[model samples]
Target: MAEIYRVAVHYGNDNGFVEYNLETKTIKVDLAHDEKRREAEEYLAKEHTIAVAQDGIRDFKDQKVNAAQDVESFKLALTRMWEAIDLHVDWSRPA
Candidate 1:
């Protein structure tokens, strides 16, 4: 038997819920309350993408600015940027 975890998430003017099955490693989204579910989904997806991109950009900028005169620090900063990119890609994948 698999364990299922349920979570309710609210954003903007829309309300939605998500269910995760641990054993199968799958997630299901339920947007039952919203009349415009498709539009709301699209809007939320776009907002999430934009937010992730902004965070990555901000992190990269901060890392570069703080790395000033240290070669090792700059290399570490680059590594952080690459890691952020990988994370963003993973996060944006469709369920």
Candidate 2:
């Protein structure tokens, strides 16, 4: 299986890892790693802006639920999420 896309976000003392496999049209999420958890907590603690932190925390909170949806829907949600958090997304087509 080939992975076409993957991104990991650490925030609000939580970790969300997303990976998409092109061959299978499947997405996997991992949020239980100890290392990633530490990173997530560090990011939350180091964040200086309240608004940004709150937004990120909100997104992280829904990561698993959103990822459980259909692939296309999850893709859209992911794009919106990254955009909302000021993360750059270079789409193959218009996002």
Candidate 3:
């Protein structure tokens, strides 16, 4: 059977948010807007800035952002990254 992989984001204190990589399954903290969470992915893709990240994270963040056109394609890529992490991060989980 296939796996359950998706990008899941939950609210935190003071507008803070936690993002799951769904690919490497790793999570990163973005203090910026919702888009920033996805844009930061450029670091994963090795892009120069968030502009090109849209082409990568388009479907994930917005239909626009980087110079690329297709957005949904990017979102599609996040599925794997989103599944790698634990998703829920409250530091309250049993250790």
RMSD (Cα, Å) for all candidates, in order, is: 14.2, 11.3, 13.2
In model 1, state the lDDT of residue 61.
Answer: 31
Error of 1 at 10 (Å): 2.0
lDDT of 3 by residue, 5-36 (tens): 23333333324333443344444454445554
Please give the ranking of all candidate structures by lDDT, highest first, separated by commas: 2, 1, 3
Candidate 3, residue 69: lDDT? 22
Cα lDDT tens digits, model 2, 1-95, are: 46456666543545456555666656554556665444433332231212222355455332222332345544555555444443333354221
Give candidate 3's error at residue 22 in angstroms: 21
Every model's TM-score = 0.32, 0.36, 0.24
Off by over 4 Å in 2: 33-75, 82-95
On lDDT, the leading prediction is 2
lDDT of 1 at 21: 58
Among all windows of ten consecutive residues in candidate 3, which has the lowest summed lDDT? Answer: 62-71
